[model samples]
Target: MVEIKEKGEFRYIDEGEGDVMVLLHGLFGALSNWEGVIKNFSSGHRVIIPMLPIYTMPLKKAGMDGLADFVERFVETMKLDNMILVGNSLGGHVGLIYTLKNESKVSRLVLTGSSGLFENSMGGSFPKRGSYEYIQERVEYTFYKPETATKELVDEVFETTKSIPKCLRIVAIAKSAQRHNMAKDITNIQIPTLLIWGLNDTITPPLVAHEFHRLIPNSKMRFIDKCCHAPMMEHPEKFNRILENWLENEAHKAA
Candidate 1:
C-alpha cells in the first residue's frame, strides 16, 4: 500500500502533500505498522515513515540515543519543518527525545503505547529464541484479540527473534529504553501533544498513559477499549478517527 524510497542511508515512505507528518515505528515494527495512518492521512498530509535501523545499527550505537540521533539526521537531511511526529512504543521514546532536542521543528506530537516512562519488556525475560509458540504468544500479547496476532505477524517476529545477532541488538535497545526514563525531561515539552493509548496495553499499560498526560503540560489523552499496545493495527479505523479529529482540532486551534 506504501512505497519506500531510499535516499543515501535513509529509507522512508513519503506520500501526499501539505503539513508533514512523520511516523516512527516501534522496536520490532515494520512499514506495515503505520500502514493505516499512511493510507488514511496521505490525502491531506505528507506522511513519512522512516525504516528505523533497529537490528542493523552498529552494536556499539544500538541504543535510544542512537535511534534519536538517526532521526535527527533524517530530519535535517529531509529538511522537514512544521512536523507532526506520530510515534508508537519505542518510536515514541525516540520522538520524545527528538522533540526535546529540536522542539522548534516539531509542531505537534502523537504517542501511542509509548515506553518512555515505564515498561515491562518481560523484565529481561528474553523471548525463547527458537520457539514459534513462545513468539506467537508474545505477539498475541500485543493485541486484545488473539486472532489479531495473524500467522504472518507471528512468523515475522519469530524469524527476527531466531537470529542471535538480531536478538543482541534488540536486547541492547530495549534495555537502553528501560534505563532511560523521560519523567524529568517530558515537562520541558512545550508543543501541543496527543497521547493515544490502548486501554489494555500490557507493556506500557494505561497507568503509563496517565503519567504521560499528567506530566506533559499541553497534552490530551484518548483510550481505545479492548485494545492492546498497537491500536493502529488492531483498530485502524478508531485510531485514525481519534488522530484525524485531534489534527483537525489542532488546525482549527492554530487558525
Candidate 2:
C-alpha cells in the first residue's frame, strides 16, 4: 500500500501481482468509490485506483487542466506498463483519454456508463452551471431507474460535493466538458475494449453504449438489466460476472 500526491492531491493506491488493472472512478468519485470492484479484482490481478485530484479542493488554477497529463504522471509515478483499464462514468471518460493519449500503456480496456463517449446520447450533457443544486441534479440524472434513486445515494453524492469546494468541481467539469467528443478519439485506441452500460441508465443510456461500440474498433458492449450509471454499486454480482467473462475471453484470445 502506498499513498502519493499527483497534481497537488493525495491518492490512495495498492499494488499486487498478476496482470495490472487500473481502476478509475467517475467525476466527484474517489478511489473509495471503486472499493467493491477493486476487492473483486484484486484477488486475481494487480489493481491500482488513483484518486483524481481535480475534484477535491474548492479553488483551482485557471484554464482547462490537462487530464492527459495527469494520467501520464500517474502511469510514470507508478511505473506501470501493459495493463487493463477499467473506468466508470467520468472515470471511463478519463480512461479513454488516457488510453488514446498513451496507447502503449494499456492492454485491454473496460468502460461502464462512460461519460466521455457520447455528446447527445443522454439528452445532451448537463447544463453549464456550477451551483451545488445544479451539480446534484446532474448527478441524479446519471441513474437509469428513478425507483433505485434513494435518499442515501443522493446524500452520498452530496457528501462528496461538500468535501470539495464549488470552484474546483466546476473547473474539473469545465475542462472535461470542453472536449466532449469522445467518439472522434475512439479510433486511436488499438487495444480491445469492453463497454458495460446500465439498461436503465438515463445519464449515459444504452444507445450511447451501442454508439461507442459502433465507433471504437475491436470494442464490444454489454448492457446490464435494471442497472443505471453505477452498475458496480447497483448490480455488483451481474457486473462482476460480465467482467469476469470478458476478461477470461480476452485472456484466451491473447493466448
lDDT, candidate 1, 1-255, per-residue tens: 678899999999999998899999998899898888888999999999999999999999999999999999999999999899999999999999999999999999999999999987853377778889888888888889989988998999999999998999999999999999999999999899999999999989999999999999999999999999999998999999999999899889999
On the 0 to 100 scale, the lDDT of residue 168 in model 1 is: 96
User: Candidate 2 local accuracy as lDDT?
Assistant: 0.72
Q: Which clashing pairs does model 1 show?
A: none
Q: Using lDDT as the measure, which candidate wins?
A: 1
Candidate 2, which segments miss by more than 4 Å at Cα? 1-10, 56-65, 119-140, 144-153, 159-168, 171-175
Off by over 4 Å in 1: 122-124
Q: Number of the top candidate by TM-score? A: 1
